[model samples]
Target: MVSKSRSEWSTILSHLVLAAVSLHAAVTSAQSSRGAAAGFLLQTFAAITMLVPGLNTHEDCLAGAWVATVIGLPLLAFDFHWVNGDRSSANLLLGGGMVLAVAGDHLGPEGCSVAGQAVLLVVSVTILIVAVFTANTYGIWGGAMLGVAGLLSRLEEDRLLLLPKEDVCRWALTAGSWAYCRALHTQRLQWE
Candidate 1:
């Protein structure tokens, strides 16, 4: 029993490692096409493998994970299909989130004053709606890269830096970053 328990943990730990490594590679490669391609590939595999963990044991948490994945995954497949011009649901959650995030890409700390902040708040909240539904590495990685690029392009002392004026828009990216780190470090780290 003891060894069996250890083996199960080892399995879980392995998944965590792979998730982490993939996330790291994906995030680090955000600036280059080769990196982006590779990252996406890794993320694709990670999601596929993640789907099977619930089978090893039947627990409520695993069941919930499965349900969450099912609820969130179809849009990615659909989107990827459209991108390849194939029009299938192969990457559904990925597809839908991309559409939303791409549209919301413009809301950044730009000429933002009090009025601007109000507009940004509305936009960020809209973006967050899509972001919340995304549970995969693709959504997290994409958002992280977008946020990073947005921050760099804006390139200002006051705007780029998080400070007292911070609000949800300021930390809107925290979810993606948080998910990226956790996926890479905890789940993807162990992937073979």
Candidate 2:
């Protein structure tokens, strides 16, 4: 087995922290903006995070990243509408962005194998269906992403290994999504 060097692990972890910190700051900055635009900004950030780098790969990492955006982006939009002034239409924009973002991720993995692509397709469609029927998109997305991540980590079942690079990248996206969602939730508490 080819083992990962220590430097590679360090580099991966650093990127992970960078992803979390950068997005967390964006969320904090959005707090001051206090409007539907803030949600859109976060949605934009989510697009960059997954489709760009940090979690740049063609497997569960990409799947989980899309799942996170699908879940968190909508929450950010809803909070914008219900608390940050009266922009109900922004919620729809957010919902649309969430689905579009996930679809983008599913479609863009240039290196994923047929089997890997199959996994992502199955997972994304399941989450999309649930999101359509359920009110808690966040819960559904998060759970689905976590489930796919776990499947990626498993020893068998025709899967990819969670290499150190992939590990940090995946967790970083997940952590960033959580941080932003938490910030929006905190804002909700203040309004309440």
Candidate 3:
């Protein structure tokens, strides 16, 4: 078994922190300029974390993608005010993502391949895009959290070992997306 070194762990920790801060800032903000600036900062860090050496692999990308999707759900809820309205769709997406993640974790090992993973990745991206368009703020975050979680489950099931690299990348991507969305929303508010 290969043991990760200190630097690797540090890199992962940084990524995780930035990711959390990205979402936290967005969720807590009252859609002010400060929140927008913080969101941009968070996205920038997220991109930087993804480019870290020895961390760019298919699995890492998938894991990163999953983290972004799963964690973004709540961010969306706050943005769209889903709690006040019928939140059945949001709830359904949340449940579906969880179910897929678990199912992927267990059933993924049965038949896994690089090509299959790639296809899944594409699907995840598509969902993210659709969420951005259809649901707006709510869709983007919710879709991200759900998509990433499901993808992570499948990757975990298939891989011989799970490393922090994938997770770091996932969180980074997720945070970056949140930042981007938050920034866009803030800019739009300024115009209104």
User: Compared with the true structure, what per-residue lDDT tens digits does model 1 show for residues 1-192?
Assistant: 345554345445544554454455556544432323343344434433543645434343333322222222233223323323444333434444345334332433232222222322332232233434534454445445435433433333533233321222223333433443343332223322
Local distance difference test, each candidate: 0.37, 0.46, 0.46
RMSD (CA, Å), each prediction: 18.0, 14.0, 10.1
**Which scores greater on lDDT, model 1 or model 3?**
3
The candidate maximizing TM-score is 3
In TM-score terms, candidate 2 sits at: 0.35
Q: Candidate 2's residue-wise lDDT over 45-136, tens digit each?
A: 54455445555565545564454344444444454344545455445645565556546645545422333334333433443343334444
Regions of model 3 farther than 4 Å from truth? 1-6, 19-23, 26-92, 101-105, 108-192
Alpha carbon lDDT at 119, candidate 1? 28
| TM-score for predicted model 3 compared with the true structure | 0.36
- lDDT of model 3 at residue 86? 32
- Which pairs in model 2 have colliding backbones? none
After best superposition, candidate 3 residue 142: deviation in angstroms?
12
Candidate 2 error regions (>4 Å): 1-3, 11-57, 101-107, 110-186
